[model samples]
Target: MGSAFPRLHVITDARPGRDALGVVTAAVSAAIGYQTPDALAVQVRVEDDVTDRAAYEFGLAVARICRPAGVMFLVNDRLDVAVAVDADGAHVGADDLPVPAARAVLGPAAVLGATCREPVSARAAVAAGATYLGVGPAFRTSTKAGLPEPLGAAGVAAVAEAVGSAPVIAIGGVSVDEVGELRARGAYGVAVVGALAVAADPEATTTALLKALA
Candidate 1:
């Protein structure tokens, strides 16, 4: 799964006119049809208010959607759900489980992702067994609240440099237009939420995002 990181990662979210699972299906279907499933990973993330049962069901559905296509399916901040659903792994933020704890829960083979905004945290995350880093709020975003200031492209570059071999995935307010800039700045890839969730045509939007990365 070395090539699995540094690819397009779609994080699920619900907003007006957007069915999170629907958008995920469309985006993933498009990626599979375009022969880029290997370049896609979907993280099952719902609002904090959602019940664990609901998140677990959603994770199962996403796993079913991704498994056949060989796309990695991950649960956000839910190690139990990830394990129960047999997902590829789990993604954790600063407020969620600590890196080593998450690694412990998921064990050595699971793909553990950690969020990092600066060099020190990036190093700590890597040392704690994070397979990859989600470095962001690359630009201001509404998808997540109380995020620190946006880390622009240069900020992303700095974190990427600090992380060395570990993949740095830029997140928060990332759009198709910003993918190239992020990649050029040494970001392995991006984790998107609002951009595709609210898109009028998510399939086409996914296609455009992949093209940009290409």
Candidate 2:
């Protein structure tokens, strides 16, 4: 509620052998360089097997990187780590805490995000105090397994229209090239893991993403 939620979310790729912190740092630096730090948000998402202590340490580092740069920092599926690290807020998915519960943990004034794949869920999430809606597999993604088939743009539009003004952030397989199409289809923004996490030049990729959003 302090400021509008960011349009471009750089979700940490904590897959085995990936440098989550390094990717977050690079993304933050890129946001700062563009002089639109506030337009980018960093979400720290580690594997379920990751201990709370490890998640906290990582979230703390990301918060440190994002705070001074004016970028919002959120922890995924770990409200404890979010509160422990004093993150801007937390993001909750189906298997995680409910939107109301997450909002309760973060309290008022914190940015709360909830994942919803369809219109009914999207409306319910917004009604339950979600600050934004993470809606997708707008396209295919290998980052997370066991997801239903990609929603594509039409599915995202249905969710977006249902939620009204609540920002709909299209996730899964999001890339710079698809940003415009997603936005045109009523996606307020996008959340990405592979696009930047595996990029040869994160800064350039970030720049392209921001430009596409614009």
Count of backbone collisions within predicted model 1: 0
Separate clash counts for every candidate? 0, 0
Once fitted onto the true fold, the runs of candidate 2 whose alpha carbons sit more than 4 angstroms away are: none
Candidates in order, TM-scores: namely 0.95, 0.97
* Candidate 1: residue pairs that collide: none
Model 1 / residue 133 / CA error / Å = 0.3
Per-residue CA lDDT of model 1 for 1-214, tens digit only, reads 2355538999988544569878888988889777888788899887888788988888888887788878888889878899999988999988898999999999999899998989999999999899999999999998888889999999999999998989898999999989989999999899899898889999999989888886
- Deviating ranges (above 4 Å) for candidate 1: 1-3, 15-17
lDDT of 2 by residue, 1-214 (tens): 1266689999999888887788888887787788788889999999889888988888887888888888988988989898999888889999998888888889998889999999998899999999999998999999988999999999999999998999999999999988988999999999999998789988889888988887
| Residue pairs whose backbone atoms clash in candidate 2 | none
Query: For model 2, what is the C-alpha lDDT against the true structure?
Result: 0.89
TM-score of 2: 0.97
lDDT (CA) per prediction: 0.88, 0.89
